[model samples]
Target: MTASTTRRTAATKSRIVAVGAIAVAGTMLLTGCGDQTNDGEAKETKAAAAPLADKLPQAIRDKGVIKVGSDIAYAPMEFMDANNQPAGVDIDLGKELGKVLGVEFKFENATFDQLVLGMNSGRHDIVMSSMTDTKERQQGASKDATGGADFVNYFKAGSAILTQKGNPKGIKNLDDLCGLTVAAQRGTANEDLLKTQQKKCGAKKIKEFISDQDSDSITQLQTKRADAVITDFPVALYNELEGGGGKLFEVVGDQIDAAPYGIAVSKKNPELRDAIKAAVQKIIDGGTYGEVLKKWKAESGAIETATVNAGK
Candidate 1:
């Protein structure tokens, strides 16, 4: 039992202690890792189980952003302001609508011709352009208004002709364009109306203009390439007013056809439709609608509020 025996016993005890401490630390780390993995899996499961629509509204509410779409070419209704931001009656209406729904309005710029297409393609949640509630457009093409009754009408309008100041060509009506060139934006009801007149009334030689909102059609008039330009009554009137009213252009006769401006929504989604209709009604009730029209100097027209469940 000498000095050698004592040293050997001490060394053996130290090694055993070290091994035990290492094992305990390893076990604790493994337990901690396992708990973290379990917590993450539970969170994922809860998220996956939630319904998309139920989750979407909350996300929108939390973010305070409502993505809105519009063709910014139309004036007095919806257009880009000098600051390059969205402005107009429709733009103002959209902001109010978003507020009613408890969200911030974020406008996405698009062409007047592509607004509806963009909505149907799921690129936007709402379209605030001066869209007419027609049966054909409701069903995504020119046809019957069978499924179009679901939309909510915000304004009413038709078509009108914008001609050079004083009607120099004597282009008083659709009849004057028998063989003369007439310009209308492509994909618009104006284009359709002109084509129909050409066939039924013999007003042939119509000129189809692409990007009709950028003063290009007016350019056609200035250069004498087009005898006249056909567009929505509001737009035609605005052009005449901004273009020096009677000094640069004039609107001849009354608007063609009868239509109402409406905001389009998916026919299958009645809830969304109801929500939008409610927002629009709130604007009208709050007197914001009239204020917007006055700000843009838009022609006052008949406004009939449709019930949320009326057409549905």
Candidate 2:
């Protein structure tokens, strides 16, 4: 797998701010739970116990908080909001999962490159970044893998091509990129797909970036450094709708390589994995799942069931 860097400092700062705020909030929420007044007040203060709590590992139940590793740069999925708060589909879903597990979900921001490493190192209990569940990732075959991670698939996504508004280069599909310059985040399924497609169609110049920080690959397209950027369908659409102010980029072909985006867990933590799978299903059954997706305008990616290690 190719290694690349993400966006610049400003974006990184924003994510840090969001993670800090989330951490503070989680601490406060947990602290506030200990002081109950009267019987009525105690009842009101008490959070509904999760039926799945007994299923969680003893360590996690004792800790009362699940430390999550995430790359918060992916907007509409996981990103910083205007007030420097963590807000997005993944954040909301993780929070709901925490509630269902009767624990606080604390998000820690890291670069896309650091998440898997952090998870394997036990720096984080789980990973809620918008990571795609591919065979390579599931097998931990990348440069960063100490042990491969398992996935609890919760959302769906597909690869898409993004170009300048009106598609000046007239690129209609991946085939058209055969001899053109393309930009993609290194170590991603999209990059791998591009490489495979490039081989099949002769050769094309693929400009790989260190991270999918929007600034790098999108900048490449804006400056004509590359003819196109191949990324997740929702990401490309979100950039066009929100990031670019609706005037910078446009989606160029039907979404391809559609797959589920999974909540990654260490293969060593099957107990936690089963607990999360149940928690996600609870969220979906309770309708919180749909609400979160709708809030981010990502309802199209919502899956009916949360399955463990279901990635292809």
Candidate 2: residue pairs that collide? 4-210, 5-210, 5-211
Let me know the TM-score candidate 2 reaches against the reference structure: 0.81
Error in Å for residue 12 of model 1 = 32
Predict model 2's lDDT versus the native: 0.80
TM-score of each: 0.73, 0.81
**Model 2, runs deviating above 4 Å:** 1-48, 203-212
Residue 14 lDDT (model 2): 60
Cα lDDT tens digits, model 2, 46-157, are 3346767777887887667899988777777877889988878889998898877777789888877668888999899888887888777788887544467989999999
Residue-level error in angstroms, candidate 2, position 250 = 0.6
Instruction: Please provide, for model 1 over 234-260, each residue's C-alpha lDDT reduced to its tens digit, 9 standing for 90 to 100.
Output: 888888888754478889987787577
lDDT of each: 0.68, 0.80
